[model samples]
Target chain A: MNKEIGPIEDLIKKLNRLPGIGSKTAQRLAYHIIEMEDVEVADLANSIIRAKKDTKQCSICMNYADSDPCEICSNNSRDDSIICVVESPKDVEAMERSLSFRGKYHVLHGVISPLKGKTAEDVTINQLLKRIENGNVKEVIVATNPTVDGDTTARYIQNILEKYDDLIISRIGYGLPVGGDLEYYDEITISTAIQNRRKLD
Target chain B: MNKEIGPIEDLIKKLNRLPGIGSKTAQRLAYHIIEMEDVEVADLANSIIRAKKDTKQCSICMNYADSDPCEICSNNSRDDSIICVVESPKDVEAMERSLSFRGKYHVLHGVISPLKGKTAEDVTINQLLKRIENGNVKEVIVATNPTVDGDTTARYIQNILEKYDDLIISRIGYGLPVGGDLEYYDEITISTAIQNRRKLD
Candidate 1:
């Protein structure tokens, strides 16, 4: 008694499961896929499969890569002495987009959140510590998101690395974006930026 | 000298090619895929490839299906005598969701559009005619969208099938949708409803 034409419905259901895609959007996308040339559709599908199958996390930085050591980690030109610690691969991408960081990255995968039952132990923090302990790392920059969990995770990492007093550790500053007005910026961002403000010499 | 990570950028670019997915959304989704559990991400990737590889147009109705005839077309209980013609497989789904039609469907895949260079020959109109000529079909309901191309396609099909006067060919009537407001309704929709007004008798 099910009236739906089977394969199309199955595809829509699958598309709906993707993050941020709703039922209507899924339906639209399904229709678009069907309308596409067979080769184009097949290529799209193949790309998705290949992306998942061929990629893996770098053993060192935990960023997605085609090999054990990601391109960034293995690159000879990168500053191996400085590690930019971030919450996710997207944060790594964001930092890379800025073209400011020449140092390598360590992807935490997630930040500490008691509410979400995620602690420092649950993430790649141990791997990061191992990397630092193994060699000539001079600095660790905590570039996690400017959220509660991010701050907590950063603090935890700082406390753990405190034993290595010879190593320098810094945090990326939080504030209203360059073009953003103070009035439009959230209260927490304003307060955090003010609290963490550094004096000019 | 491209500061961007190659594979990550390529993945984001590929994701942006999907309908309605912008750069930011694509980046977010790409990152999400990167962060997902290996099995779950693999499943998503596999689903996309499987959908493309396994699905094809039902030879009879031109709707998407794994089988040549499609489940609906092959099903004995469906009213094969009455063919509800629609623009795409999604339209068939919408009709099914309403639970209003018991007949089998003929998906045109697209409507006639001179602007888009989509002629009657480009769609499955010939296949539909061939089905009707095979002789068991009693009625053909033109259920295309209420757009100009939709109406033109319906009219074109009606004209083409006019030779078979013995067959009953009809277009679904235009009316204000349930819970839709008259004031907010488009002029074309309201005008069409008025022009196609039904007689209660």
Candidate 2:
């Protein structure tokens, strides 16, 4: 049985509710929290509350933002003519870190996984269709993950976007990661990479 | 530039302040927090605040408690005459789990580590002395972790407690853990275990 007080026990219970955190991790984190200074603990609490309350969805791209149109959606420097669709806001951050994609983004929030109870309507596919309906977007890049669900979602979106006569639809390529060793790569990944091999420029 | 808005960025900063948590984990946790329901997020926030505000040191054992005396200190069933001295509340929880020591506890909060600027005076060593003085404490068990700092602190406490004519002072044994193979045991640990080996029935 745990020896922590009622409040500490309750804190552990609350922490355990988060995804990927188990009872042991929650208890450990709670113990660590109590050792911190009072002001720091208060700041942690304030940040959680603030993030929940302050963040809103970008009207255009559906990415999380402090304002209606997210930082990317509002910024005129980004290439609005090209829209990249991803699975979550975290993906948006990853793309931003690369500084490679200068275009805007549409967050699907999740891929369509029938087994996981996720359907086409659950994501922001409809919003994306409406956003690019005027044909201002010259190309649409489906940058979902390489998982089975991600592939299926990308294909589903591709089929719909193919209706636009002038819209150029593309999916990010599958290949061995830059730093990954060839010996460690799985059979399916190697085969897929070989099948999609391109001519060296 | 970070893609997340002000509150999300602030939350990531605050989360990064936690021990053992890095920038990537903080960002992942922040993204997870933002996606949670408002009430669940509020509960998590409230738990942190309440644990910080409500948890106080037990007057007797110095463990975190909702009340001053704490559950273990006030429980008459425990052997008050056997005072088990430990380094933290977490240690108390671990000892309790073992079910071997059904006694009272003294929390030192830290070991006397000169490198970390911790002295004998920094922990509750003085309070322990005062509590055991002219009292019914039959034996004092030093259950500090088996580290360089912990061993030094235990020896120092033992030297002082030895002055008492009738009091029995004991250090928890140094031996291979239960179910551990001697082949993988370090030299120091194997030698110590051999030196302290008991006569089997």
Candidate 3:
């Protein structure tokens, strides 16, 4: 029995489960948590719970929101005819941060990856197709990530939407480095990448 | 108004408040939280709240505990006569890892630092003196950090305990680097440093 760890070991284990947080980082964070004021620590905990509890996927665009339609979906100023579909809410945020994309967003929650056992059905592609079929959407920009899975998912969606010839189907530019996660890229690169997007033949 | 930030910014702000987590790290963590399973995210949040709510200071020694006396203090096999005084619960965990000392512990919560506006009264020095006054403690081992502030606090405690002729007062040795933190030091170094402690007088 590693009696040395005691209660703190349990705390480190919990923290280590967080994404990108290794054991060493977890230990540092756990020590910091123990040193924090009870109220401060409690508030941090509450925020996590609140974010999970309050946020839901938008019914129309699939972006995260407190309401089903989401603030962006419900808003009147957004370009209703242009829907930018992406892999996750983080991607939606990345696009929005550029201050250039005024269209609405559709968050797929994930991409099609057979290697990871993720199929097209596993993502929100069906919901996206339903939205496209409903009408008034002039353009459907596939803003999925630059990964193999993202590209595959984008192609699959484009093929499905090709049946609706009246709608313009386009993919976001691919200047973003292959295999680079979108969340780490800056606003300028993402904006330039978006503006220079190529039309898929 | 930066509508792109919206609710995501709130999550990032909360994450940044955590110790050692900067804005970039906080953003990464917030995005990760969004990506995680709702159950896993909830568990992490609940752990934070539970750790803060369920844990408290041991009334006798001031070490963090789920119960008043703490497990070490309440344990029958442990030597209650030797109280290993440390700056925080993290220190207590360090000593416990060594398994070199089979005695109880008293967490001071902080050390004396006038530059940071922390004084002797700010720490648990009075409680320590009171514990010593109970007459059961034969040795009070000051295992506080080895920093300048730690040294000052240890000296201050030694000065206060000088009035009591019946009890033996000792500070952990200073072979630890002058400016280094105790939390990062290894078990062997800490154990050797403690075993080699010399008399202050």
Candidate 4:
């Protein structure tokens, strides 16, 4: 019945475009949507539109926010001397979830991926360098993911920031995840975790 | 940062309501939604709203459709005398994908299950009986899923349909799925497949 170009089919196609969603999942989502109240469905639709329109790129950290400087950048308690550099706003959320870092963040919006034709210019590399060169920032933490692009991006940023004599650039270590089984870890992860083993307090 | 009831957080909550979407998946979908063009995301939202607004239950078969009687029920190409009974709209889509059934469908919207407190009154059993009695229907195919609930529903329908001496009521066979491995099939499937084996041409 949905083989026709009806609204249900259209919704399915649109839902399938989201990451990790396939045709089957999209279909299920569409059916579930039909079951929801009209007001609730409208709220969902309006939420998406409002999120895009109201959320701006934070001038300091480049994280998406309703305010210009963002909550993190404006917070006086957060350390201004230390800045954690990440690939995206989602990474900022991940770091925040850990609740360990009480410093500022710089969102690159993406990593350096040669395969995808993304280079330093494509990301916020120049802005990161400018922040360091402006002085007062003591340490820079490269908190990119463990993927090839993330590592490449981290290395590239480190190389550039090394020119600033007072700036100390460090990388977030790749280690066995907390509570992860050693036997289940991949070879590369195990080796890296071993190589970057930290001294126990 | 998104722990706040911000736009991103709101979108995540909305996304999590969809079937099979957990909090993590919802977050991923929310981020993906932000990456998408405003027009595209708006289209997805509007499509869901439009689908619910436009599609109505067909009076005859009780399937969701743009108009009463639905396309299949009105189409002369479809076999009017033979009706396939299914639990949901998705099941009708599955049957249509096979292109095997030219006959129309009757969507009960749910299956009979005592655990869930569903009874003959809960589903469209009366409508199905009325359709058969009012029309010149020759046979009824029970195409509910192969779950415990599906089997229970099929058996209940069969018991009631027995009163109509002229109508033939049949259940779709339970067997090893075509191209499925014999070694991996459960005992019930293997046994049922053997018993339901038919004469080949």
Candidate 5:
């Protein structure tokens, strides 16, 4: 009995396609949007278009950027000799949030997920290797996620880069997250934490 | 240490302004949008703008519509004499979903909330009275939510319309939702359900 409103329905369907938005949430959002001021709605629409059109993949790091090299890649303060390789641009952002890494980054775009038919050739693995082959790079940290695909991708990169005797290829440590409770942690995490236990400073 | 990507950050900020989206959810959505195909992102953005530009409020019912009168208002089959008055355009959609109500709707836009400084004069009460003044309407059902403001608004409307001798003003029934367990239901709901109970057929 619900009479269809064409444009609003279209908007709701479009919103429902987003990662976490459900059909109900989409409906709520659509109604909320209709209630919003015209100028505010216009601003939201313009921002979406601007975000899509203005951002480009950084040629050097393969991260989303407004500029070719991106702010991190072009910065002289960051160590060019050390590179932290990650799966995606969002991963680079997460790494940066830790505020400890002063090194440059290489974004692989994706991991080698065989189940999904994503091979090493599918992502920017060659581009990452090309960045490290410049001879100036000494430390190459493989900071991909701890999933099966992440480990496979890291291993593949490590196997190829093994000839570089001076370069240090290290995976980011995997253990219980900081401030995490021991009782709540899974068995693998607890064991890994024990295996990678550090000396008291 | 997370260096701002101009357009992406702006988009995230814009998304965060939405009713239910948190900062983290906004960031995730922004990233997802960036990952989407150019055509898909354009479609999504265009839909937002189109929804805003296309819809107009029905002059008769004050519901959102592509046409001035709205589909429901213009439908000759719908019972105009029995007007179902509710808060907001979304409430009209909710009512339509039930499929039992063939009557037309009148959207009040908001309830009289004294806490929020909204009075009976602030909403579309005058417009509602004007509609009833035409002598065509015989029954007016107040379907505002079961809140303090809802009760106040319903009472206010009922008091004002009492002068119309033939008009029957009624409020929507409040009871336990379908498939809801009685043990989980609040005391007020159980009491209301008992008070409004109908005899077994």
Candidate 6:
């Protein structure tokens, strides 16, 4: 019953291998690609290839970027003394979107997941340590996700950075987000919110 | 707040242009693509380019294929006297998956959608007429979707083929799909099913 033509089938298979694309979505995308203008298709392909070829990890922060130092690392106006540690480059984008964090970022590339076989050695923790050791960084903020592996990675970083006598290690607050309702939040979040409660200023 | 890097943002915009891929999904896919091995990334890009470059509309049936006539049109064992007309290549694939349609296909590429300004001339209705006129075709199974445009296109085709006394133009049955419950079906589908009820054999 599998009577797909060669090029179409090949495209579908390639698309299906992506992170979130299912077989049905791959099929839809393949057909849409086939129907698109040749110039548009070429542009899409060129962008994919160009992005892969041009992008490199920032040597300092280990974040994916077009240059070695990355824009944030090169910018002197940003607070170089404070570094926000995150699991991926996308997290850096999220933090930047918030517009509140005026510091550099160190991308861990991944969290420490025992079940997934990702360890401290697998991530860019060594690069982060190297940055901290070489720079006059005063504060390190762990902005990894709030999942189990996120907490584990945060604690692991805190343990390793404890030797830095003057450096302040902080984890981003764990609680309901802005505009979130108490009733919609889970018990763990509610408890965490209560535990981290502060007096009115 | 828009401090995204050049190549990364370009890749995200290109990916976001694809159907069903939102900004968030595009970000995730872009990051995933960046993390992928160089060879895998090249393969993915190459496949996209190759699919577009190699594919051509079949001269006979207007279906996208690497070859001129397409596999289905060139297959000698398939019933040439009966043609299955569908709206797109994906629909042809769906019909092929059913394993019941043992005939060649005619891809309309689109249907007559007044809302979308797609008329009979926009689709390959002329190519279909050319196929019917030149061949010893006896039956044409209109397997277009059960949308308003689909019905309009099917009726338009029927009206055009009325001059051919020996031709059997039939619309594919529209009713509850296999494993579909009556309660779950919409009012229109339930009524259509009852209207087209067959004697139990």
DockQ per candidate, 2 decimals: 0.33, 0.67, 0.35, 0.71, 0.71, 0.75
lDDT of 4 by residue, A88-129 (tens): 787777667655578899999888999999999999888877
Candidate 3 fnat reads 0.45
After superposing candidate 1 on the true structure, give the runs of residues whose Cα lies further than 4 Å from its correct spot.
A1-13, A25-46, A181-183, A193-201, B1-12, B28-46, B133-138, B158-169, B175-201
Candidate number of the best TM-score? 4
Give Cα distance to truth, residue B40, candidate 1, Å. 5.1
Every prediction: chain A TM-score: 0.94, 0.95, 0.92, 0.84, 0.84, 0.85
Candidate scoring better on TM-score of 4 and 5: 4
Q: Which ranking of candidates, highest DockQ first?
A: 6, 5, 4, 2, 3, 1
As for candidate 1, its clashing pairs are: none
Candidate 6 structure quality by residue, lDDT tens digits, B121-165: 999999999998999999999988898999999999999999999
Which wins on lDDT, candidate 1 or candidate 6?
6
User: Which 10 consecutive positions of candidate 5 chain B have the poorest summed lDDT?
Assistant: B1-10
TM-scores for the candidates: 0.79, 0.89, 0.78, 0.91, 0.89, 0.90
Compare the candidates by lDDT and give the number of the best one.
6
Q: Give the candidate order by descending lDDT.
A: 6, 5, 2, 4, 3, 1
Candidate 5 lDDT by residue in tens digits, A1-201? 675649988999999999999988998899888878889998998898889889888998899988888889899988999887888776676666655578899888888988999998998988877887764898777766767788788888888888877877877666746443323445455445434533211
lDDT on C-alpha atoms for all candidate structures: 0.80, 0.83, 0.81, 0.82, 0.84, 0.86
Task: List the lowest-lDDT window of 10 residues for candidate 1 chain A.
Answer: A1-10
Proportion of native contacts in model 5?
A: 0.76
Docking class of 5: medium
Instruction: State, as a TM-score between 0 and 1, how close model 3 is to the true structure.
Output: 0.78
User: Relative to the true interface, what fraction of contacts does candidate 2 keep?
Assistant: 0.80
